[model samples]
Target: MANRFLAGYHAAFNQYGIWLSVPGVDVTASGPAANFLLRPDFKCEQIIISGRVAVAAGFNVDVMLPITVPTKRPYVQFGVAQSGVGQYPHDLSMIGTTAQIECIGGCLFRSDRLTFSNSNASGFTFYYDYLVFQRGIN
Candidate 1:
C-alpha cells in the first residue's frame, strides 16, 4: 500500500546517494565574507565543489578548502581572485574547485577577505554545489 511505497522511496534515496547546493554565500562592501560548513555526518572520500564568484571592483576574492584533522589543520588553496572589471561591464565570473580527502567527515569552505582595500565595489557572491560520493558507490 501507500506505506510500502513510502518505505521503498526512502530506502532508494538513502542508498543511492546525496547532493547539496548552497547558493549566494555573499560577501559585501562593509565586510565579513561568507563561510560554508558541511555536515559532520558527511562520510566520503572525495568531494567536488563547483561555483561562481561574482564581485565588484576594488576587492579580490579567493577560495580555500580547509580539511579538519586531529592536529595541525591546513588549507588547500584553489586560486587567487582575479581583477574585476568596473561596475558598468558586469564582471561576473565562474569558478570550479575540487578537493580530495581521506575517508573523513565534515569540511569547510572559506573565502578570503578583501585583497584590496581601495575599491568601493558593491559585493561578492559565491554560488556553490557540493557532491559527496560513498566509498564504493562511485
Candidate 2:
C-alpha cells in the first residue's frame, strides 16, 4: 500500500515518459497485449522515461542498474535504456508482417515484424516486448 501511494505521487509529479510493457519481457513489468501473438497490437505501452539519446546498433544499454533481492541492493542488474535505439516507429520495424531479417540479434522478441540487422541466431519469434516475469517468490 505504501508503494502504491509513492508510485501515485511520483507519477503525477514527475515529468517522465510512461509506457506499458509485457510482463516478464523483463523481470518486473505489466504484461502483453491480448491476442498479441496474432497481430501487431497497435497499443502504445506507456513508459516513464527521462531525456533519451540515440545509440548505434549493439549492446548499447543506456543504464546498468543494481538489481537487489527485494532488499539491500542484493544483485546488480539493469533498468531502462538510457539512450533510445529507435526514435521513430519505422526505424524499429519495416512492416507489420515479416520482413527480411538481417540481424540475428538473439531473441529480443517473438514476432515477425521484429528483426535483427546481421546475426547468426534467430532464437525466438519476437511478437512484442516479450519476457517471462519472476512469478511467486523468487
Candidate 3:
C-alpha cells in the first residue's frame, strides 16, 4: 500500500465564490480536490528496464532492460527493481504522475547519459520515500 495519507499528499486547492446576484444565485470554482485510487501499474512505473542480476548459486539471471532518463530540468525515472524473493513498494508521491508517456513498455534506445541540464544550479530535488536497499549490495 502507498503512504499518501501518511505523507499528507492530498491535493491542495483554492475555492472561490462569485458575488452579486438577484436573489439565490451563487457560483463556486475549484472545489475540494478528490482522492484517487492508485493503479497496479502505478505501483511500479511501467518503464522498460533491462539489467543483469547475479546470484551466488550460479543461477541464470536476467536483465529486465534499461531505462534512460531524458535529461531536462528535473530528470526522473521510476520503475520496479525486481528481486528474486520479495516485492518492493512504491512511494506515494511517485504515484501522482506529472508526465505521461504513450509508449510505456520500453522506450526507444538512447545514449546512457542524459542531455538536459539547467544553469544557475542550486541543488537537486527528488520526491520519494528514500530507503537503502541493503549493505551487501555492491
Candidate 4:
C-alpha cells in the first residue's frame, strides 16, 4: 500500500509538480500566495495540505488540487496553523472532505475564499503548517 501510494505521489509530482503534504510543516506562502501547480490532465484520488500562510481578510488564498482523479471522488485532509506575531497560535484540522471536481480549462482549482473578519480584524493572517494526502484504490 505504501509503495502504491508513493507511486501515485511520484506520478503527480512528475506530471503536475504537486508535492505531498508534510503534516505540521509550513511551506512558503508569500508572493501571490502559495500555489500547487496541479495540471488538470493528471488524475489524483486525494490531496492533503498542512501549512501556514498569512492572507488578510477578504484576500484570497488559492491552492490547486485534482477535484476528481478520473471518476473517483477526491478526499482532502488538512492541518492548519493560524498564527501571527504576539498572537496565540491555533490549530485546525479537516480530516476528510470529498470534493466535487469540476473543470473549466484543464486544471482543478480551489481557493480559500472565506473572509475571517473577526480573525483578521487586527490584520492577522491565517497560517497553515501541515499537509498530507492519499490516493484511493484504483
The numbered model that scores best in TM-score is 4
Candidate 3 residue spans exceeding 4 A from truth: 1-46, 50-52, 55-67, 70-84, 89-138
Give Cα distance to truth, residue 80, candidate 4, Å: 3.7
lDDT of 3 at 26: 20
Model 1 residue 50 CA deviation (Å) reads 2.7
lDDT (0-100) at residue 129 of candidate 2? 25
Q: Residue by residue across 1-138, what tens digits does model 2's lDDT show?
A: 111111111122121122333332321222344412211124232222122223234432222211212221111111222223433322344334354554433322121111222222443222212122221121
lDDT leader: 4
lDDT-based ranking, best first?
4, 1, 2, 3
Model 2 spans with C-alpha error above 4 angstroms = 1-5, 8-46, 50-53, 64-93, 96-101, 106-138
Candidate 3 residue 17 Cα shift, in angstroms, is 38
Count backbone clashes in candidate 1: 1
State each candidate's clash count: 1, 32, 9, 14
In model 3, the Cα lDDT at residue 31 comes to: 21
Listed in order, each prediction's TM-score against the native is 0.19, 0.22, 0.16, 0.32
